[model samples]
Target: MAPDDERLLKLLTTAIVNHPRATMKDLAVLAGVSKATLNRHYGTRANLEYQLEAHAKGVLAQITRTAELHSAEPLHALQYLIKEHLTHRDMLALLLFENRPKTPPLENEESYAKDLDAFFLRGQHLGVFRIDISAAAFTELFINLVYGMVDAERRGRAASSRSASTLVQIFLHGSVASAASNLPE
Candidate 1:
């Protein structure tokens, strides 16, 4: 993407994170652009939302790349991802809570889902993760825990309750192999 587009995406994401149901005009104002510019760029609310979802998928892909989730040992990758998600609490809020899953990814974005599925399957095969849950559910639970911690911290609802280590502990204890499940921390 061009630098201009990237800038717009960042501004728009921040706007949405701050006000999820903002009108196009509201978004433009929050994004520091005019309504005309927003219209010229996005054409419609649907288009804007589609772009945001794509951006979220792009962020997730970036996280996976940084974690080397496919190439690294699954346990390490999982731990890195849990910590990374905490480090990216705003992104998690945008992805998990603020953005409703109304738009499907474009054709090019489908591989992210496939890659995560394959990685979790690898973990299960290696006995790093539990076999009882489907890969999709396992992934969902992990994300939900991260979201909970992020949300709690964002709201200033808890101090010690919202640490990434706590999330990692709770998530790993439930998701990992029975013996290793005792090993969250």
Candidate 2:
């Protein structure tokens, strides 16, 4: 994408994040550009959704790249991933709430799950995460927790950093603080 298009995408991303129900015209106005410019770049609402999904996927891929999912410490790897994810909470919310393309981005669901599944599996093997739960289930739980934490932050219930810690703790040890105290120290 050209620099100008990139700028528009960023503006549109912010607008979508803030006003999910806003129409394309509203988005164009929020982006400080005319509808013609938005149309010139995105062409249609579906196209705009497609581009937003692509942009979100790119951001997630970049976060995964930085989190170093292959690192030896599974719990730390998970924590790092959560921290990186916290930075993109708005984009995540937009992706969650927006109308996604029927085909999905990058043509496969694993585009979002591959790295997360690997991390969760490693954690389970290392006994950092529970074995009774399948990796896929654990990953889904983790994703949901992250989304809930993001929602909490949006509602001012907690800071993003605190939410990240809370998510990791709950994922690793269940909701009760004393639930895992019997484990080897």
Candidate 3:
């Protein structure tokens, strides 16, 4: 897509994130274009949604490229992924809102899952994470924590450094204050 096309799509996505129930006309206004222009570019609301999905895919691609998820300790890598995802808060919001159980996984999703599983397995091997909990379950917990953080931020609850540390601490250590300390050093 042309640079202008990309910018307009981003604007449309931001608009949608801000007002999911907005009409095409409302979106056009938010995108700084006329209804005719939006229609000409996107053809229909469904088409606009399709573009948004494509944009979100591109965002994920960039994150995967730059995150270097394998370059750090498994726990640190997971934290890096969370921070990276949070940087694309608007796109994440759109993607989550559009998520449906029956929706097929994206092409890259399988690889992403494998990478996460490996990360968790590494943590388990290092005794940083509990081996009793399946890696898949741990991954699910990680994703849920990310979603919870995003939701909290969106609801006017600003995430602090302490909030992030607490999240990681909880995931790594559980609720018991001494759980992490008791782990083998």
Candidate 4:
């Protein structure tokens, strides 16, 4: 996408975050574009919503790719992944929104799911994560834990300041290898 379009998408995402129930026209204004322009570019409100999902997917894919999950030490890479996801302002805000369209959750995303499955499998082999469950289950569990932490922080059930580390602890505590589980908390 062009830089201008990307900026528009970002602005729109921010608008969505700030005003979850805003109409398309209101979103366009908050995003610093006219309704006609938003319509001209995206053709419809649903298409704009779809673009948001695509943008989010790209953000996640890029974060995972840069984390190099497949090649790094499993525990370290997993920590980095969780930290990056939690610190991503746009994604966090989007996740907090109650009214975004029906985009599938990140765990169901095949491209990154495969990478996570491989990473989990490696972790299990290295005696970092548990082996009782399938690697796919680990992958899904990790994603859910991350998302749950996000929700928890948004709802005041958790503190955002420590959420990343807390997420790592929560996920690893339940998923870690039996021997690794004996380490100091």
lDDT of each: 0.77, 0.79, 0.75, 0.80
Over the stretch 21-89, how does candidate 4's per-residue lDDT look in tens digits? 788899988998899999998887778877776787777777889888878988889889998888765
Compare candidates 1 and 3 on TM-score and give the better one: 3
How well is each residue in 104-123 modelled by candidate 3, as lDDT tens digits?
46776666666677778877
Worst 10 residues of 3 by lDDT: 98-107
Report the C-alpha displacement of residue 91, candidate 1, in angstroms.
4.1
Q: Tell me each candidate's TM-score.
A: 0.73, 0.81, 0.78, 0.81
Task: Select the stronger candidate by lDDT from 3 and 4.
Answer: 4
Residue 43 local lDDT, model 2: 89
Kindly list the per-residue Cα lDDT of model 2 for residues 73-106, writing each as its tens digit: 8877888888878878877777777665564448
For candidate 1, write residues 15-123 as lDDT tens digits. Answer: 8877989999999999999999999999998888777778767877788777877789997888888777676666667777764556655653566666677789889
Tell me how many clashing residue pairs each candidate has.
0, 0, 0, 0
Clashes of 1: 0
Clashing pairs in 4: none
After TM-score superposition, the amount by which residue 36's alpha carbon in candidate 1 deviates from its true location, in angstroms, is: 3.3
Ranking by TM-score: 2, 4, 3, 1
Instruction: Give RMSD to native, each candidate.
Output: 4.7, 3.4, 3.8, 4.4
